[model samples]
Target: MELFVFVCAAIMVLVGALGVVLRSNPVHAALSMILTLFGVAVLFVAREANFLAAVQVIVYAGAIVVLFLFVIMLLGVDRAEDLRTEPLGNVQRPLALVLGIGMFALLTTAVVRSRDSLRFKGDGVKTATLEDADGNIRQIARSIFGDYVVAFELTSVLLIVAVVGTVVLARRRKSERTAS
Candidate 1:
């Protein structure tokens, strides 16, 4: 049963990724990202990291993706033609392809070489201190609030700025139309 769930989640992740890459429209790509985030949450649930799964769903799938769609809609970038311009020059596509292929080869080599030597020994040092399910949640909370508080605060401030900037732009457009 677990295996089945994992396989389904994995397949959905792959499909969502492909949708994001292949879709011409920005809104469709954002929707695909939501699907991908959900799939990742499902995988986290399968691993017994329920808090992580909830965070993934709430933070990435719910909040971040909504912001992406909001920006896309606000900017009216849903049209395919608006996205057709490639500013990286004519050689960007071929260069990206070569780099992507090279990265794939390196990753494949690492995985192949590590298969014989690398192994999961335990819950890991970070989580080994966690005695119960609640401990996992506490550990995660500590990591976020205690160790990464500056980054966390910065992210929140950045998100707030983005939302405010969008509203300002929207108001400017409305005012321009009224004055005209």
Candidate 2:
């Protein structure tokens, strides 16, 4: 049963990933990304990471995807862009390809070197069980709220500041446009 669930979730993830890459429409791609996120959430559930699964669905699938769709709609990407246009000149593609190959080579070398050292060493860690499903979540909550509460609250304040800054900049641009 668990194997079946994992296989189904894996298939959803792969299909959604392909949709995200292959779809030409930004809205469709964002929807595909939601599918991918849901699949990942399902996988997290299978791994007994309920908190992570909820975060995956709520934060990524809900908030992030909606933001992406909003940006896509706001940008009005309905018009097809010319693929042949070299806005950055001919050097950009070659540079990107070379850099991509170099990064891939570096990652491959790192993986090969570290493959043997990547063994799981969870010695005294408590995992979720049927009797205590919230145990893992409680531990995570304690670590975050107890040990890192200040940092977490600081991050929220930073995000709020960023949102306010963006709104101010947007309003300034609109006023400038109207004045012009």
Compared with the true structure, what per-residue lDDT tens digits does model 2 show for residues 42-152? 999888788899999999988999988888888898444444663858898789879978998999999999999988875343578889878888888887899899988
Error of 1 at 140 (Å): 2.2
Q: Cα deviation in Å at residue 170, candidate 1? A: 9.8
lDDT of 1 at 13: 95
**lDDT score at residue 85, model 2, on the 0-100 scale:** 65
TM-score of every candidate relative to the true structure: 0.68, 0.74
Query: How many residue pairs clash in model 1?
Result: 0
How far off is residue 120 in model 2, in Å? 7.6
- Candidate 1, residues 26-102, lDDT tens digits: the string is 88888888888889999988886788889889989778899899889988888864435747678887798899889
Cα lDDT for residue 133, candidate 2: 76
The RMSD of every model to the true structure, in order and in angstroms, is 4.7, 3.4
Task: Please list the C-alpha lDDT of all candidates, in the order they appear.
Answer: 0.82, 0.84
